[model samples]
Target: MAASKIPGWVTAELFEDLLKANVEGFSKVKSFKADSGSAAGENYATIMLRVNIEVELQGKSRGRSSRIKSDFPPLDGKSKPVSYMVKLPHQLEMFQEMMKRTNIFDIERTMYNQVVPEIEAIYEEVGVDITFGARSYDLKNAKTDYVALEDLGVKGFKNANRLEGFDQAHTERVLQKLAQWHAASAVRVTTKGSYTDILLDGLYKEENRPMMTEMMKGIGSNFVKSCPTYEGYEVFIDKVKALQPVLIDKMFDFAKVDPMEFNVLNHGDSWSNNIMFQYDAFGKIKEVYLVDYQLPKYGTVAQDLLYFLISSTKLEDKLSKFDYYIKVYHENLVEHLKILKYSKPIPSLRDIHLALFKYGFFGYTVATGVMAAVLLDPTDTASFENFVGDTEAGLAFQMQLFNSPRFRKHIQVIMPWLLNRGALDM
Candidate 1:
């Protein structure tokens, strides 16, 4: 866990090039400094930077500072925010070892620089002024990948508390934006076919399957273990086990669908923490920006929606407003597509219900596993490597998190409905 003196996931040459090329100023490089990033909410593989520069133009010189985001760092989990399994050093080792062979950094870089611009353009043609992701500059994906991004905090955008998720209004605003994003992607797909293939390249390569499987198993076990009050527990367990072998396929199958099914480029990792919002004069959400694109997947649009709903919305609000939220998303999507002159069948309200029913396991797994990461209290959390190296203690620490009463309520609300609807039937 030795700290490197290197400033960040960046190089000096690219840093200066960025200033000259993207920064709107007559500038000479002065200094670049890496700000200590917060491990509280940031993932491993993220770094923050501030650039000090002298702006000289028209015989005037002034000093200015620019904020930069470094999304790709050394694969070692030490520098990244991987407190999740870092205590169990072997898990971190396993993840780091596997990542070396994958092109995850390249995936994200391509997403921001290439894919999103196209998604936005589709919306623009139809007269809907839309944007995907936050403002960023000097995007690059190389041996050391980094980007100089707009300092969103300075721009008045702030993240929702990871622990306190979206209420109804918050969910509606986000779903509207999500619809705009997905509608654009569908339009792009209708006219263009090549990018989806690049996004799908070896997405579930054999080398990575085992890790995903293990994680799903833990999620399933944790949910069943935590929720002791749910009726028909034995039935749920049997169906979950029956679904296990096929669940991975179903999950990845979301990326490849029948042409008739409505599909889009998924935010892939959409949740509260990755999204930031700005408020209007009345303190209502005016705009939202999706940040991470590291795990972009082309899938059934509901796959992305369900992941965010499961991971970001409070269980009580989601359960009660399920139909209403789905309708809201469908309406926004239909309007955008209509304006774009797309006639292909959009997902109906019925289609949405079916998708949610079919992908119920997807939501459950995310709720029990990834959602725990979303709601984790950074204050009491740790990856003190040595202590977590103890097998029993590390596992207990993970289980203790999702074993709370609230999580149990989430499981109860989620699992029973799926069972009653026969959603888990193979």
Candidate 2:
């Protein structure tokens, strides 16, 4: 847990600065220990730090030193080792090029920096309590790209089981919070003006088009091949294959506009893994936090809703509670928007239904791959450094995903459903 064990991306000086910025009344930092249980997320390396400090002032009133315990009870600062996540700019030159081109790190930086303040402002205006991703350091013009966010785990927010997805109760909690954020979009435009300078979200970014095209090429090829033969679904298979060449392009187009309303900035990756929830004193779920803003896209809220349902909820839960989830989201949107003083007409339940249907492609196009990643055993997963070591290795890693039983089970239901809904069609 020594500071030397910290990742190379974040230097000791930088971590100290972040600690002082977030932690209060600590004049001299005595010792900092890294948490041993940290793991590397797909795009970032997450290490934790336990920081201790001495409240020594430079020229304060002749302070007595010995046995001077304060009555504040240590300021109650014990949270499961504040996580420090550093963006992984892959060591491989080619992959680094892709990383920069896709702006994986940059998008998150933008979200934490520019967009989150706007989000917080709207939340404050609406008088609600919410938490974004970990608190970031030098977020506006961050050099190495790191964030010191509160670990929701410390706050009792636990991850949903990726293999099983979440039930309606958990999904309901997430949806309600999502509506609040989405409704705030209406307020943001009015107050914050615009954000033309920052990098656009993934689906809107020109640079990401090529990378997504490449990734989708692999995902789509395997998806089509997963379906051996269906008596009446060959046309859907052909459609899916045809999409191989332009699936990425089509995704961008599908999300370009909402027929009923303007697009809200969505948590583009809202799978079960990206959300955390906590229970109330009564042991019922009461709070939700959406993590990982790397792919925050400006689009229909239904886009986020459907993606969450498809990838994060079990089939039966989705079938049973799909309509009810939408209703909760709609109600929250209407109520929170009223709180925000939004002038635009909130989309009704019927409009939201149609919106979800229209945005089904957003879910179907990426759900299989997302679900595959969710099901992957961490032991079998490759680190970003090793995964992008070579083109063949990268392709091999993808093939492993395509062949996994978890991925296979997911596509069995997803592929056929997308076909039935014509969500895969251009």
Candidate 3:
């Protein structure tokens, strides 16, 4: 796929309008350029802009090249750092159709516009500053659907290496943030009302389940075929095969929110790529931000926790600190819920552990499927298109990726871990 060209609607006027609204004493836009923001086969096309603007102060004007203490500088010859990551529909035909059918853009808009703002406000009322996502900009462009987000990269945030996964520090930081986020959303439900219809179900919505089913079948088939290639994994092959027929159903059950159970708005896609971390000068993570709300769903909090632990943490941390990590998450969650004066009965640590067992299949599926994508060799040819495609090349690519040494090693650990927990049981 080629770099996405700047949309026709992204003109000098748009940049000037944006700068003028945010920058004090804003004047005119000097220049701007758009470049591809993300890799190929990513769901949305992200285009970033290096915009140069002039803002007036005390009847004096300066360009972006001039250093200012604010988020944006005055108009100098040099362009300001890319401020916003612009999201547009995917360039691929198949992805475009799937995105439209799922209304991912619309759901994301609701998340940023309505849900996040409300959640943050709850935190502020309790004097805890929290940000779950990038600040969204309201831009009404009739030519195409787009989302303009405050670029976290400009704030020194970046994704951890997917292959390396998160260590104890990084994983704990993410869990802390997730707990607070979950706390705020839970309180928001009681304070405001239930979440909107758009956030009800994400990946496994009835309409999309057929597609997800096929994807799961592909992974399950390849996994079973490759099991013989690895020595001790033969024990898991039959168990995995038994799961193949019921895998999609179990996934659906885990994703769906049970009315009797505690629930929160889950960051439905919680893999490494969807999370960004900012580091201090010492290379320690200072802040972490969750991104890609295209799959936000209201479900058991266990969904996000299990997915992250299984798919994004290092194997040692995952194997050794699993319960400890869950305890950390619950501690923060209960703390914030009480601080917010949540009315409902607070869920106990036992409650969370029980939920983990109930949702263990969700974690297993992610370990087998999403972990491959996370540990994928960047040099290899892969994308969502070929990942789910039925073509010969697509099938070959899938098998090769599943059989990667990194993935094989990870799975060798994950399968036995899941079996011990009875996660393979249908």
lDDT top scorer:
3
Candidate 2 or 1, higher TM-score:
2
Per-residue alpha-carbon lDDT of candidate 2 for residues 89-121, written as tens digits (9 for 90 to 100): 434555566656565566777787778777877
Please, what is the whole-model Cα lDDT of each candidate in the order they appear? 0.62, 0.63, 0.77
**Candidate 2 local distance difference test against the native:** 0.63
Q: What is every candidate's alpha-carbon RMSD to the true fold?
A: 7.4, 5.0, 3.5
Error of 2 at 166 (Å): 0.8
| Top-scoring candidate (TM-score) | 3
Q: Between 1 and 3, whose lDDT is larger? A: 3
- Residue 206 in model 1: lDDT: 57
TM-score result, candidate 1: 0.79
Write the candidate numbers in order of decreasing TM-score: 3, 2, 1
The candidate with the higher TM-score, 1 or 3, is 3
TM per candidate: 0.79, 0.81, 0.90
lDDT of 3 by residue, 1-426 (tens): 232566667765666666666664465554465666666433222333433333344235434333343455434543333356777764666666667658777888888888888889998998888888788877654366667788787789988877888999999999998999999989998988888787877766777777777656766787788888775887778888888888888877876778788899998888888899999999988888998887888989888998899888997787789999999999999999999999999999999999988888887878877777777777435666567766787778678768888888888888888888888888
Model 1: runs farther than 4 Å from truth? 1-14, 29-31, 41-92, 139-143, 215-224, 227-238, 241-250, 253-256, 379-394
Cα misplacement distance, residue 341 of candidate 3 (Å): 1.2
